[model samples]
Target: MYTDSATYNALLDGFCKCGQIDEAFMLFKSFRDDGFKVGIRGFSCMIDGLIRSKRIGEAEKLFQKVFDVGLVPDLILYSIMIRGLSESRRLEDATNMFRDMIGKGIVPDTQCYNMLIKGFCDVGLLDEARSLKLEISQHDQFPNTCTYTILICGLCRNGLLGEAQQIFNDMEKLGCSPSAVTFNALIDGLCKDGKLEEAHLMLYKMEIGKNPSLFLRLSQSADPILDSASLQKMVENFVDSGLILKAYKLLMQLADSGVVPNINTYNTLINGMCRAGQVNRALRLSEELQLKGHFPDSVTYSTLIEGLQRVDREGDAYKLFEQMTENGCKPNSSVYKTLLSWSCRRRKTTVAFGIWLKYLRSLAGHDGEALKLTEEFFQKGDMEKALRSLLEMESKLADFDSAPYSIWLVGLCQADRVEEALKTFSILEEFNVVVSAPGCVKLIHALCSGGKLDKAVDIFLYTMEKGYRLMPRVCNSVLQVLLDSKDNTILAFELLDKMKSMGYDLNSYLHRRTKSLLQHHYSLRKMENVAAR
Candidate 1:
């Protein structure tokens, strides 16, 4: 029953630190009710916890309480209040508090200034942020790595790459070593601004370590440097910019530097090559990376498999997929989806079915323990326990349910089993499971192929309603199917109109076919009417 002030303070601090703000406040209230004095540390903990929990209004109220209790807010308390306000985007209130602190002869440290600068930058007040950065020096506190990085990131976000780079240069000139975050920000800005070469060069400089003289020489030198993470990002940027060849050359140069690219770097290059339609080159790179002691990850194999499928090299893709599994790299949902989509698209129903079966088998191991428990309970004649075990198995199996069903649905559609796929799809819909876009595409294709125009249109409309963008191929297929019959010309026109309203691009061939079909339908209708008369 005898609690000391330090004990109460410790209890309050612990509760606040663990995100139990309510409990901390209750303790504070209890101590106050017991005529015990709660110090500024207790108040600081409460305020910080409230702010962190996003209860900014409550934090503000507690802060005002500090003054009501006749306690002069110290620099630490002021810093906490200022930071909370800044983070809450109440920049004006934060600035006023900051000024009040300064009026009390409290100089802001680098961290305090950085927080304010970050707040300004977050709201696109770059001018104000820069002014604050200057004020840090006026306070005789040099901006640290974090301060420079924040400004760089802010400038990059605002598309002020030039200003950002200048700050980066100034940061280095002031003997502040730029961190990985700083380099990443500047490099990301360069990449986004279509300055791939400069991004690459910057990455090279980053890898050579932080020597000013070396940075200068590297700028003019053709020698490549290696930083796995940053270089991996730059490789992606290059590929995105259609500079695959340049990215490849950079990778080759990195290889010559005796620094092997990581699996991620190889994956990026492999993905880029695949997207560029150089599947052969991508396959070769896969082999090359493996020879260099970097085996293909799930991502590498998935990217390569998808690429091969795009080029109609299903056999090679399937082989690579098997290799992926054989090499102890598990095929992810993406791999299964890719294989299913291609098999369905190409009408290789058997192949699609096999892939789906394999996916199901892969998931079988996940619920093995639960299944064993269920079997054991059943053997023991404990029906209640067996039922509970079965429920556990069901819950575990639910996690793997949606994806496999979508895959199987695609396979079913490919086998011309439209009704069954639709039934499965409806069950998914009831459970709020969204079929993948490819699954939608395959279903529509199968419906169109089966001359189920009404059903195809229904699926097409539903797919779009679900915000799934079907490929243009499926769109064209639906149109062609409708246009194949003179009777469905009006339906084709209506679907085209719907597609246009939905912002689907209408290719010229589709336009020509629709117009020709419309003309023929109208002419035939006109002739039929005349004959009737």
Candidate 2:
């Protein structure tokens, strides 16, 4: 089964793949000495291995050797050479090789197009990548599903989620089905953009849209029919597993086809409707659920409560709250937290505090204890304790942004934990968190007071870069610190000029003092120069 040439080629390729170039060349020389015609496969293998090893120069030279000798390379060789160049980020070389393929009358295929497009995308040349898509269309080759998936993923990675979605829609319209990887790109993009709710919806779609029952799942296959019992069992399984979104979609489809949904299916639909902020739809579904003998449970009431709160229907929320209690459904901490948060959002701090107080003793040694402890510690100036309590809260709620991280920043400053304070501020900035200017200023002042002027300057410059202007009073205090603690008078004077440019009008006394201090500094410098002379 193995000719000597075939065996030698395989061995050479294995050496190249493993980056053993010297042995591969020795084998190549052995082939040449044995009078075998130069193998294109051996050349392609070496090119790829060199590229993978980041030795693009050597690959390029080998490519030139093949090209210069007018060796008629096959499609695999051409594709391999182009891929190596693309992966090496040598875009121009890849382009030339692409052209060379055409000039050599070798017809390029979809993989070649994909490689070039992916190369452009990797280098942030999206317009070029799109232009190639149009070029491919001009060649009368419509993009396949992989092409669309590649473009969609590339656009999303570049923060062009809208464009990615447009392409995704185009893919669907063109009869190109989306794979899990394609959907995940958009989900990941939404998460990166901090659109957590949108991300959740996409996840809902991925889960429920794709995980249909047997008949529905097989609708695209050769046999698309199932018995009534099988369909009912499928719906029941979806409902049992809490796949509410899928169950709701399937139930609605079933309704259109004259099959009324069961109670469990209706409840699932109602819950999904509430979560999607279609509270009115949920209400209608609730009425229909009861008509179907599906009594609303505690989950239904809780979902409705949240839905009502989301829509700012506080009066209706309370009415439902009373209704749930009268029906003997005990209110849980989640329900109370939702109520307290809504009340607090409405500026009813007193009512919110009342709600918290009412629940405090009931939730002893539970999650609610952290919120209570944070409140108590903050009010009592026990910032360290407050910060720890907040960390505990964050451990449970991934999207927790109850208070500005600036609160802990101020506490860290007051505790003279300068390094910790700066690190915390950096974390807040990295997340694009809106910190209070007063708290940042407090940190700066604390640093200045501690005579860590260099660190203070770092924070000041960082804040200025973030568009937070330094207060005139703070500037004056920093200037005082600079004059007293640091010997860099030129930097002090530069700061004075910056203050003037920023329109921070100094008081008359501080004005005279700064001018007088600068004059004295200059005179002292001049005297030192004369003494050296």
TM-score list, all predictions: 0.43, 0.39
- lDDT by residue for model 1 (290-369), tens: 78887788899899888776556678888998899899999987898788877766666556645654564576455666
Candidate number of the best TM-score: 1
Worst 10 residues of 2 by lDDT: 223-232
Give candidate 1's whole-model lDDT.
0.77
| Model 2: per-residue Cα lDDT at residue 40 | 82
Provide the clashing-pair count of each candidate structure: 0, 0
Task: Give the per-residue lDDT of model 2 (tens digit) for 1-533.
Answer: 32476787787776664445555776676556444666687787777766655677887788778867678777787887787788878889898988888888887777778888888888888898898877776555677777787788889889998899888777767898887778898899989989999889888877776544644654544533244444455555665565655765665555534344555555555655554445676787777677655677777788788777655568988998899889887777667777876664454544554564455445445466567777788678665555566555554555555343554466566557677677667666555565677667877898887777877776766666567776444665666677765465566777666555555555432444455666788788899999999
| Candidate 1 residue spans exceeding 4 A from truth | 1-226, 258-260, 368-407, 430-432, 436-445, 448-451, 464-533
